[model samples]
Target: MKNSDQTFSLQDISPKGLERSRKLTHLISSEIGATRQQVIPFDRFMSLALYADSLGYYVAGQEIFGAKGDFVTAPESGDLFGFCIAEQCAEILDENDVAITEFGAGTGALADTIIRYFDGKISVDNFNYSIIEPSPHLSQRQKIRLSKINSRLADKIKWYTTCPSEGFFGVAIANEVFDAMPAKRFTIQRGEIKELGVAYDGENFIWEIIECSVIPELIRDQMSNYPEGYTTEHVETQGIWFEQFKKFMKRGILLVADYGYVNQDFFHLDRCDGTLRCYFKHHLNDNPFFAVGLQDITTSVNFSYLAECALSAGFAVDGFTSQAKFLIGNKLGDHIATLSVGDSVDAYRVAQEAKRLILPSQMGESFKFMACSYRLEKNMSGFADNERFRLG
Candidate 1:
């Protein structure tokens, strides 16, 4: 579909445009059963943000990374991040005999970088590579990018529509994947925390904080520990993903890198607005009602909650740290110094960008790394011994 048919343009932000947005909002609210007096629950809100037909961001085919995209990811920073990750993957493969599966392989940039790194660093004859990408557009892109490497290695790259079952041993990596899962939003009013529900407001779309008195006992049980007046957002799909992960991997390492905080940090009084965001053409848009399905909507992951979920699913926590500490622990500086020896300025520029990715002020501090092991007996490689930190 053309951008004009689905997304809001500059003109769409005007009075008439606002009217159009209202109409669209009304349509969505009616579909989701939201009301104007209440806030639409976060999970339903996220469903609209991510999967609202062709209008949803991920389904809309908007440019998502690089200068032309909505935002830049670490893989787009350069090959170094992928190379370093590949080094870690090699360590995992060295210790266990299993294949490598990467989830949500956006643009296949990371896969290309990883394949190149593996080709140069290890013998490909012994290992298999797989990618679980639900987006056909990205899967096609990955196929094209991986073609530059040896065809034999490229052939080892398998694609799965969903995560595999019965568990395989190896490394499973997800970069910026969990944050995209649809989440439920709630707010505290009159000292009662209520779920925000979506509904039509006749002229426009509006939110309603409906009393979820009929919510499943299991879900209610999970929320029993929430303190009074503690309004927060929850990714209802997170636990489902964790269960899938456990079923898919018998014994291997699971690496996840994303921007999020622990429970105490995320649920503090200052975080009432939650971490919802929309990105379009490298710009951040706070109003989800404006763009409909054209912008990427995401919220920060709650790492502490994620860790607990993983543990409940039978995975042992390996390590958790900021990207900066993780890279420094893995000796990123040495890699930069080695790459800088080349005469090409392009190579040097790439190295500099890689440095920026790991710098404290940029993605380094904001992004975090978490590793979980399932049935692995040995310590996973990549970081110095002293760099390891407890998740709790």
Candidate 2:
């Protein structure tokens, strides 16, 4: 997956890709047709569209990262992002026997960057990298990419289809991961909360407002505050995910980096349509039903809700801040300085990447960094003087 300099539109999809999408559509249509109510919850639909067996988007053996793919992640932009994260890990794992467990290791770019950055900083015997990736297609890509690194670094890398059953100490990184989790879409209709579901209309998938029989406790109180037809998302599975994470993390930190906002900004009154978005090629759209399993569907995270889940799961809310501040706090400037003394062309490239990472109009302010710890007392370096746990 090479870096993409040009913007990609939906027109780039090939005939083969369309056929794969059609197969996935048929599979989803069949499942919805068999449902008693002729509709499935929005989260269920999203899960099927993105994670249903071999036909799902992530498992369909298609490149989904970098310029030629749907969208580019921060790590894909450059290595500075990974370098900063590696610095944070180094701070927390100081002289300790710990492994870095990364979730949804896309293309293994970040893993490769972090592992290589740790070459002289941490001893190989004290450091290991474990990837918990579910998509076999992506797993293959990661394996191929990481194998090119030094044999010693490659030997320290491990792969898992699920979280490890045994407990270990270290850091857990989830970069742009939680946003892909299936989220329940809800809207207020006739003064009551109703769930938006997906229904097959014989030709295309359509929206069906089903009665929300049991309101989620997290949003029950705010249900009445929204105006009529106000739509938003709620993720109840975060607590369950934390439960699983806690099992393997005997004493460590879970670092989450993604685009999100605090509760007040997340469910703001003016923002009615919610944060659900779909990416086809590089073009963005509000409709998730457009490409079926061929596109990426995601929703912005609610950090406040995530904090509630962490507290319930016995984890301490250690720190929270924007990605820009976190990176700056973690010595992004030092990297830029070092690179500036290198080849002139390389310095110019690093400058462009740094702007994209720290500029407010780019991913800087939009993305957030959150740290949740379990039985660990040390504060992470990325949040030094920039910690905003109160906002979380």
Candidate 3:
């Protein structure tokens, strides 16, 4: 396994940092083609930049989440977010012989929080929990955190670098994972489709157009009506990876939560720049070329495409809603109520953190939740009232 001796921090940027970026840039160029053949699809560049074994962003031992990291996910926001998810997981686990599989378990904060919520009830003897993480560095970090916080539960959770196999039953989840996967950036030009790729200009990385597999049939049909100059993006890897995750489920629900929009809004004419961005030290901006493997590169998910893909992959679309709505509907209020009369300091701190999660200006509206079920035929509490968005 690839392990780093130290975590990469923006505060640590130096001449050595430029050299690291230079090395990864050259590695990416080599992975795609020679500099003379400069054009490579955005996804290929992204894969190398973010997931290239020990040198990629995620596996390079970078502090990529929370206050000290590049960005803060819901779990890093506080324990309340995980509590809300745990409330739902509690229900899912009430069933007999089920395991929880999580993809991209960042920092293991959510897993730790959930285990605390469940107390000593969930054990490792039967392998009731598993995490699917390809980044050796992140997996090692997660192991250390889980072991430190709750060592006994560490054995209960198994880590797999690949998707689990067929005939498994459990709750499958991915928190902000789909967006992190490589995405192909494309734009409409002169009413024809063109793909955006990366190229090296001997000195710096540049964007170039390239020929790739046509956009998926589902996306093509959706974009046919858009005007020229329209720009948007899609994650081909997301669909394929979800299909692999779907394979192991004889019956269970896959809850995917990320920031994105439906087809209409995602490919809207005015969204010409697409939703690609790089995160470094909490600074959100475009230009993945800035830090190479030092920053987080992600795109807004296309939930419309996601919904269609789940159906095509042979799963039922269980529910869809904004994160705030899902959390509110799933008993976030109830959890907050329990904290309402706690110690003044703790209560106030908890309330403030909760606000950031549900407020419109925060993660509430921008981040969306999608639940797909395989063979399971029951409604989940998270989608109880605010499930206005559902598959036809």
lDDT of each: 0.70, 0.86, 0.78
Query: Which ranges in model 1 have alpha carbons more than 4 Å from their true place?
Result: 1-9, 12-30, 33-40, 95-98, 213-231, 381-390
lDDT of 3 by residue, 1-392 (tens): 11112243445676775677778977886755664456888888888889987778899886788778788899987788888887777676553454788889989988887777766565445336788899999899898888887546556788989985646687888999889889887767677778888887776778877765477665577677667766667788766866776777778888888998887778666776778888877776677877799888899988878887788789988788889988887689878877667688878988998899989899888988888888887667888764536333
Task: Write down the lDDT that model 2 would get.
Answer: 0.86
TM-score list, all predictions: 0.84, 0.95, 0.91
- Residue 313 in model 1: lDDT: 86
lDDT per residue for candidate 1 within 223-326, as digits (tens), equals 45555544456786777788888888888888898998876677656765677777766667555555665567788988877887898888888777787776
Could you give the candidate ranking by lDDT, starting with the highest?
2, 3, 1
Error of 1 at 128 (Å): 1.5
Runs in model 3 lying further than 4 Å from the true structure: 1-12, 32-36, 95-98, 120-127, 211-213, 339-342, 386-392
Candidate topping lDDT: 2
**Candidate 3 positional error at 90, Å:** 1.7
Better of 1 and 2 by lDDT: 2
- Best of the candidates, TM-score: 2
Which stretches in model 2 have alpha-carbon errors above 4 Å? 1-12, 96-98, 386-389
> Candidate 2, residues 295-343: lDDT per residue as tens digits?
8999999999998888889998888999999999999999888767878
